[model samples]
Target: MMFRKKFVLFFGFVLFVTVAGAQDRYFTKTGKINFTSKAPMEDIEGKNKTVTAVLDTKSGALQFSVQMKSFEFEKALMQQHFNENYVESDKYPDAVFKGVIANNAAVNYAKEGTYTVNVKGKLTLHNVTKDVDVPGTIKVNGGKIEASSAFNVLLSDFRISIPSAVKEKVSNSIRITVETKLDPLKG
Candidate 1:
């Protein structure tokens, strides 16, 4: 009986360790966002250099963050405007998201499958914080995991003051896209 108890304990310990190590980390140095506005008329898109995403299978937890200063556009002047007047990247250098997949057990990272999940988290930009619910797609194929999410942020929510000179040139909403390859977390 004692031997059986010891075996059970050992098995349980191993299971715990295995489960803990199953979290996956997917990262990218280039994440993109595009903004389009009418009237004054402008098209803007930028890429960030530091982006990290953490996914936990057991808990269906997802956390992501990016450095605001990393955003770079084709035009140097436009990029400067974005950082200085729009995003104020120097002041609010990072944007973070923390949430869980609504359907925890429905996603299987080990096999090829597509799962639609609702992600709820706080998004901070230009020193303003807002709660958001975003829909995302998670696909696991050939031992690789790809996560994609698109969300919109309102300029007013972030307190980004639009200058009267170009008030109509910028859009009130900004669209963001996140994509990356996930790597299994180590013990």
Candidate 2:
């Protein structure tokens, strides 16, 4: 009985370690987003701050979330209108993305290389969710991981209504870029 109990405890400890090492989560303090729209009069470019992402490497899954309230435009009036009317950031403060990496190939995180990843996930903005396919590059080097992606999203798909007054200022399609750093799982 004593031997059996010892063996069970040892096995349980090993199992815990194995499972704990499988999933890791990370976040970056500086993440950015860019937007562009063309009108008959002028072309506009805007940027946003405050993006966060969580990654589960063992499961090959990732989730990225951004606060819509953090989006900034050059013009104060434009920014205020964006938050209040267009994006409704006060109501839907966040845009979340949850998806899995489609590639079956295992990534050896210890090596230095770039891997192409097919990301399929749901992107939610303005309380609307749409399926998006974003192709990105993941680089693992010297215990550090870097990920980058650029994708286009249609504003109308997210039910973001544009007022006639500022229709020309905002574009129908928004281009998004993500840059993040990955850290190892902590104890």
Candidate 3:
């Protein structure tokens, strides 16, 4: 009886601490991410609207999760080739980015203003991880926050090679954009 009671009390304490720590966190499940490849002969575009993201204000930790197959392309054939040949959705089904706000202390989350910030983190896709330093903005308004960033990356960096058939037509650099509005967690 004593062991069981102690275990239950310990579990309760851990749960309380976790919930307390999460009060300063903000999260959204419907974040948006878009990628564009503007090439000489062809332009490819894809958008994913079901990205899940979490940001802990206290620790400056931010993370994003996205399913590889969730990205939608305008052409069905392109989408099929993207999953089967490019990203291989069956083997590597998710892409994640875990980073921290470099200027966490400068931004006042309680104030209604927009703050420019730098985020440093690791982006993992297609079983490859790369370090990225991106410029972004954090907007605090009406007790809510909106975050956005746009950056260019080389497809080859993640071992994603453009197929020979379209190699000459596609650009090596691809532009990526992220946008998300987050609400504070209430516990």
- Model 1 residue runs over 4 Å out of place are 1-20, 23-40
Write out the backbone clash pairs for model 2.
none
Indicate whether candidate 2 or candidate 3 has the larger TM-score. 3
Model 1 lDDT per residue over 1-187, tens place: 9999999999999998776665554444444443433344767777764577777776778877777777778999888998888878888888777787787677776678998877776776666778888898888887667778887777888788789888777778777777767767665
Ranking under TM-score, best-scoring first? 3, 2, 1
Top of the candidates by lDDT: 3
Collision count of model 2: 0
Candidate 2 Cα misplacement greater than 4 A, ranges:
1-23, 104-106
How well is each residue in 1-187 modelled by candidate 2, as lDDT tens digits?
9999999999999989776774355456566766766666566666766677767776678887888777778888877877888788778898888998777255655579998888888888888888888898889877678878888888789888778877766778877777777766564
Per-residue lDDT value at 183 in model 2: 69
lDDT of 3 by residue, 15-98 (tens): 999887767899999999999989888899999999999988877789999999999999999899889988898999999999
Query: What TM-score would each prediction reach against the true structure?
Result: 0.83, 0.83, 0.88
Where model 3 places Cα greater than 4 Å from the true spot, the runs are 1-20
